[model samples]
Target chain A: MKLINILSEKKEIVLKKWFDKIAASYPVNAPSFLKNQKNQFANPVGYTIEETIEAVLDVLINEGTDKKAQEFLDRFVQVRAVQDFTPSRAVDFLFMLKQLMKDELKDELQEKGMYEEFLLMESRIDRMVLASFESYLKYREKIYELRVNEFKNMAFRLLERANLTFEFKDDDPAFEKDVSDSDNVK
Target chain B: MPNESKSDELKQDELVKIDYKPPKKDWMDTPVHFRHGTYIYPAKAKNLTYLGLPNPREWSPADEDWKLPDNWKDIILNGMKERLDKYRSFKVFMDICVRCGACADKCHFFIGGGDPKNMPVLRAELIRSVYKGNFTAAGKILGRLNGARGLTKDVIKEWFYYFYQCTECRRCSVFCPYGIDTAEITMMGRELLTLLGCNVNWVIEPVANCYRTGNHLGIQPHALKDMFEMLLDDIQDRTGVKIEPTFNRKGAEILFVTPSADYFADPGIYTCMGYLMLFHELGLDYTWSTYASEGGNFGLFTSHEMIKRLNAKIYAEAKRLGVKWIIGGECGHMWRVMHQYMDTMNGPADFLEEPVSPITGTRFENAKSTKMVHITEFTADLIKNNKLKLDPGRNDKLRITFHDSCNPARAMGILEEPRYIIKNVCNNFFEMPENTIREQTFCCAGGAGLGTDEMMEIRMRGGMPRANAVKHVHDKHGVNRLTCMCAIDRATLSTLMEYWVPDVKVTGIHELVANALVMKGEKERVVDIRGEALKEKKGEDNVR
Candidate 1:
């Protein structure tokens, strides 16, 4: 049997381990709130990570590097991207999944002489990691862009009120359009 | 050459290192300097003059001279003396603090910013120290050693920085042994600061606008009608239901008022749609006021006199329109004013009867003095009576949680009303952690007129506690949306949610209610109020 099949069978164990690893990165007080709480309402963030990771794992087993995998991976990576994680740490969760799978499935793969398939799986996860890194960068850049846009909007309102500028009007559709472009006048 | 390379590496390391260096002079000893990313721009001369606020002058917060009146110091001292005598709670809070430090860690701003002054105790101490020197004999003799200091220009600057940073969420009051509310202290501090023209533009401008045009946005009657027309069009496009709401019509039995942001801004506009649909369904005899268009009082951030002046219009309009009672919309500080200060400031409100929901027949005894019911209380009662049909599956796409607006929860204790409304409408719902919700809830970190983006760094820091709590729920419950009642929360928490938990979107509670309302003769629902597609493939994983 292939490593993907074995991995798919033991997906629950692998996912629990992966969830714990990602959650452990938060401050010590954060984990009980993020990991230990079973009530989904009380702990939605923990539940989302588990659900999202499971979906991503299914796509990896069924169809590697496909559109479905990209979609699922984007949802998962975007969470970390907007969090307090540095860029390297944001995508680190993707790489950890491979190590977790290899460690969890070590004996079964060796017994079936599926070690080569396991190596292929590792390379596949590496590709997933690369994709996630790109996704994280895009989301992080969006955050920076949003901060700039917020500043421009705030500056325009303050300046308009102070009568220093008459170029912008509140609630004007045209004013909101390309506010970054309007910064040149300032 | 090796030494030069090592020095270059050291310089690079220093460049990236986050600095938390205390200024060379003690913050208490040093005159508080206005730092960029901390202070707000000054209120305009015209805005101040329009509102009849004191010291109506063109002075920037960043400028060296604020152009204070000649007797500014005396005015502040005498103002404190009058207020201390008038308000027993303010006097008790000023005198009774043991500085136990329990409240220091309780504040979201203190936890997030790590600024010692952001601590509720020290923030109050900024004023208390002056109060001591001016009022007490021991303070006159002991001076700085007894934590009493003479009020000076630097002290006024300190009051401006620290008081505005407070959202008046009252989290600190929850932990204090004597129940000393920092909000009361912050209000008093702001009152004293405003005595010297030390008010921010974000607040004074709104006060002026609300005073003149009946709304903080200064939206005129014609423009207000045009905006409502736009919402009517959007609602028809999304839900195939046309709602006709009356503006400034007399003898309507009820007068509905909301923050001006609801009419003009995103997310809030969606909540306004929720109110319109609900009101239209009931065929309630209510009229919207173009005159008392605002429920939010930014004067709450300015001074008590200004709060009273702006709030007077609500009761004044209600009396003129001959409405039985009022129904206020989703707003945070607005409710704070209405619940705690409005009746005292602008009442007897004896012209209006106790608010009885026309649909549910529930009497809102909590607002008996003010005779105004919060929309959440109105709707929650309606849901309890099975007055409106709801389709929870329409909101299947969202896993939701509620952020209790600090004022509503702490001030009015209207905790369960919004939650009851959310539970009845939406199929998927979650609660934030016990410590971060209800009366113990954290501020959006940008409440009390500090929501401007100029102070993004400090705002982010202040938001960290709430953001951390939000991040917890988002990770645990697959929660994608946060719903709140306050207009400030709707505006500011959006940025906080976007920054820390990007996947989660902030929304007003009524928006969720509207999505699940199941209106009569509505076309097969396809999109939500925002015109975003509702999840079509339901019954896949109900999970509930």
Candidate 2:
């Protein structure tokens, strides 16, 4: 029996554990709300996490790559990034998959003499943590950029009120240049 | 250089809190602070100019001088006088408030952001104070003692800050003893602010887009067609069903108009797919018009006249395409305008008969005057009449909850229609807390053009109330999905839920409907509408 074969057979348990681990990072009350629904709308955050984990597992088992899982991963981490989590704490959920898989499938892997393969899976999880960290940083930067833009727009608005800087309507030719210049208005 | 104190830097997790204090000085003496997350960037000059709005000169909320014309005060005061006589509701609302403070605790912004200005009564006071000082005789005699103060530039700035902060959800109106809707007050305040050329870019840009391209996204007819075609491809790949929807086709019985965001964006696109599949399932004769692509009117956020201008196209396109009536897809403020304001603003839609759901023969008395039916009402009627084949088990994996959008619940009383459809389509449907679900429901925290990215901090803060309720239900009943009928809810609630209630996600009611609808002769369906693979049927996968 191969490691991939065992994973394929017990993917449901693996995915459920993965989803539970990620959801547990939320406040204690939120996990119960997140876990009970098999429905997507009822447990959307959980559903998204479950789908992402499942997609990741499928790619892992088949030795294939899927961009969809990364997209889901971005959403998962982006949410955490905006929360009270620090950078490391935000991306920590990605690493839980390794422990969860090792615990759930340890017996099967050892009995099937697939110890090396388990280590390989650990490396894959390690790589995912890095990817997720990058995503988390990107989201954090975006949030900071937005704050700076708000400040600049406000400063310029006040300047206009003080009759310091000039103002341009959208139709003015200067408007295009002003809006397109260095400041991130969008 | 002086040594910097440790408190000079804000903690990573600590959000800034600006507390309201009773001033030692008079209300008129206090200066305005255009704080981030509370104020919005002013409307671009072109958008205002394109619509021929007054004072189209470029202005920013951050500016010290707004570049107002010398006669600006007179212009606004006269505008108020004209509006007082023209719209009796505005006058009645202005005179009715008794400072009971009942509506203060009712607003979600106050609950989430902890800003006293977010309190409904005070938000109303930002403008009501002006109305008193300028319009009423008591204000003239009593002044600040009687809650009346002269309208200064600071007062105008305060109006821009607080009015834009409101989502116009009307939850406060539900609590007001006199039924003095804060939304009506906010609309009037926003209208007055527009007279100062002080509109937000997020709103005015959408209004300009809707006016010029017949959609809020400024999508051309070719781009709109391409989007629909791309969705068709995705549908084929996911469900193995090829659905061809008619676009701008003449002589169609119904003109189906949805928010342009549905045609272009995620989560909304899935809902759009749901609409296409549901329509195809019913074999409904409807035409999609690129010329009238937007069901939402951002102009509602600007002024009534602008709303009327943006809305005129719906009936005009309906007539041109020879559609007897219109069926609106899921949207929020669009419904508010259609249900409460459309007929009066641009009606006598007498050329079209009352909209009867063709499948169920249910005549929508609520929409009889406008000759428009909401898609949820249409679907609920169909389910009630047993018109379509449904397999609730297809949604067995979902434990869903319905979020009554503020406009539909408060403005249109569309509380039951969506719940009826959700119950029929899914097996595990739970309601949020009693206070948080219906007419008393909290806003998605991002509506009325406050849904922009720059406002994310306030949006998240404002979402706290809705998220708290969702957390309560999610913990108590194990509910995870938050279903809403509004397009803005679908777009913004996803971000809100992700930030506040990390375990919950959002979807449109129609998306779940499409998930459960068992199309005739369809191939084995493996994945749901969002392209998530469904669990294999028991004992079937192994046998295969």
Candidate 3:
């Protein structure tokens, strides 16, 4: 069987192993809890990780991305973006997929003489990593936008519109600092 | 520097090291990472000074020296001891945990963010360890083995990070066999931090504003009246009933006080209009208290003492106005304060009569002691008695689900009132997943004064469980509208919904209530309080 065909058969094991790799990224005790990934409500992070990784793996096998696949990636990357991960670490799970594919199915690809399929799959994972980076940045940017929008979402804009906001006059003593000013006033 | 944690320096390399191995250090020994988005800004010196809180100084958490009082250690220890003595519950909670870890996965923060310390039990242990080390002989003798750590400045920093991280929503307490109120523990942790002036700006600034003005936002009476006039304008445009609510009037039958957010904030302003429409329809006798404009108490986030000081104004205004009883608007922690703490903290409401809905003649037996009835309970009773003519079809455009806010659900046991009102008011209403509603309800993750902007990342992470449940229904039953009964939920869950489930917009329950309320001689209602046209077709995704 070819490497892609073998991956199709071994998809379940590959998913479980890939889920383990992502779980390893979290803190120690958290993984033990996240390892029980069946219940979605109780262990949302685990469930999302399992579900999204499975979907991302399937997308890689098809050698492209779809809306559903991108959404799965979006949801997963959204979780990581807000988490304690840096930009690279947030999307590094995609890179981990390439490493896992190599480690898990290395001999199978070598024996099957399908370096081209392996390269194609690796590049696709690479592309997915790039896509995950896009999603991660989208969420991070969304968080900052949400922060700004938070102020506007309140009675703030209305306050400004109604001219209720107290603006300091340019000539006001409080607005203009004198030469003999104390830093403590700030 | 003390601020730059060892864990942070090695975080990037340590995170991507993809080997199946143990955590680098024990959780107890693990230094906390004060990442930018994870923490809130420190309380500003002015806000702390305005509140007369201790150790007011301008310093950042990332600084080498926090400018804590020289005797900060003694201050925190003494404060802890004082609280442990005064509140026996604190002492019992400090000693009683078996750490079976029932609450580990229950925390929304931990469930969403996967942070180990965000676990309710461990978060409680963040302070409880110090309680053990300083208070218990066993902990002092046994040290880290007994899960006891000293109250170092690092420990205080960890406390500020973790305690404020909690929304005090009490979801984890629902699962605890010992029935430990983790929210109280968080409150205690915050109280000790307050001694060192180590509270968050989001919380302390609100407390200060509430202390000076009657509300957290510090809207003066004229501005408050102006805001109400704006709402009345919206009400006139929508319903054509000119609401003439008396502010701080003498001898109104009922004193109506809501979180000031209702008068000003988005979506909450719609709920405020809903209250106006309902009152107008029923001819309910109530006066707004400009002095007690805030029903939500940020003092509950600060200290028990502060809760009393901020809460005293409510009763004082009720007395001064001589309203027979008080009707609090839809707010979560406000109700938690009114129900659980208000009666004891600033009570003997002997000045006011028991709350009886003047329209329906149904006495609010639940709030007989507090003399304050929740709007939902009042509205529910009105619907129950068929006193108000509610056109349920008016809400035909929306499919709704009730998000039982954490305080109202867990703290106050207000499970049925909102459901009763929703069923009587709306056409299509659905419950979220079995575990995510009622007493097992997840928090908006923005309660207990953590509902600020800089902590958006943590809030998003913490809101995941609530959003995930909302998503479940949004996918399953086309739940386009998420109606909650909290002011914080109104302001914050809108952001959360915007982030997690973008299509689902949040509404206060009364906003739905008034949409169906048949007002007296009102014009043909075309628009909801938000100026969105009623009976508009549900477009592809949130086409409002």
Expressed as tens digits, the lDDT of each residue in B1-544 for candidate 2 is: 1124655575644422211112244435656676555567788899888877878877677779989878878878988898999989899988999989778767777654334567788888877888998889999899888889886777877788888989999999998999998898888889988887888999999999999999886878877887787778767877787899999999999999999878776578789999999899889999999999999999889899999999999999998998989999999999999988889989989989898887888888878899999998888888888887777666767778888999999998999989899988887888887877788888998898898877776777677668767877888888878899898998788877766566888889889888888776667777888878766341232210
- Give stretches of model 1 more than 4 Å off: A1-186, B1-27, B30-33, B537-544
- Best-first order by TM-score: 3, 1, 2
The per-residue C-alpha lDDT of model 3 at residue B113 equals: 79
Task: Summarize candidate 3's per-residue lDDT along B389-485 as a digit string, tens digits.
Answer: 7777778888999999988899889999899898887879999989899999999988898889988999999999999999999999999999999
- Which scores greater on TM-score, model 1 or model 2? 1
Arrange candidates by lDDT, highest first: which order?
3, 1, 2
Per-candidate TM equals 0.75, 0.73, 0.92
lDDT of 3 at B71: 91
Instruction: Give stretches of model 2 more than 4 Å off.
Output: A1-186, B1-30, B536-544
- Which candidate has the top score in lDDT? 3
Best candidate, TM-score: 3
Please name the candidate that would achieve the greatest DockQ relative to the true structure.
3
Candidates 2 and 3: which is better by lDDT? 3
lDDT of 2 at A147: 58
**What CAPRI grade goes to candidate 3?**
acceptable
Please give me the DockQ of candidate 2 compared with the native complex. 0.03
Clashing pairs in model 3, backbone N/Cα/C closer than 3 A: none
lDDT of 2 by residue, A44-161 (tens): 4555567677778887888776465577677667655555444766787756767667678868877746888788877777877778888888877766665565446445533433
Looking at model 1 chain B, report the run of 10 residues with the lowest lDDT sum. B16-25
Compose the digit string of candidate 1's lDDT tens values, residues B1-544: 1254566666664644432222344557656556666677787878877776678888876777778899988999999999999989888888899988778767776555445677788888998898899998888999988889998877777787778788888899999998998998998888878777778888888888888888887878877887788788878888898889998888999999999888777668899999998899889999999999999998888888889888999999999999999999999999989988888899999999998887778888887888999998898888889898887777889999999999999988989989998988788899988888998888897788888766665566577677777878898999999999998888788887777788989899889888888777787778888888898533324312
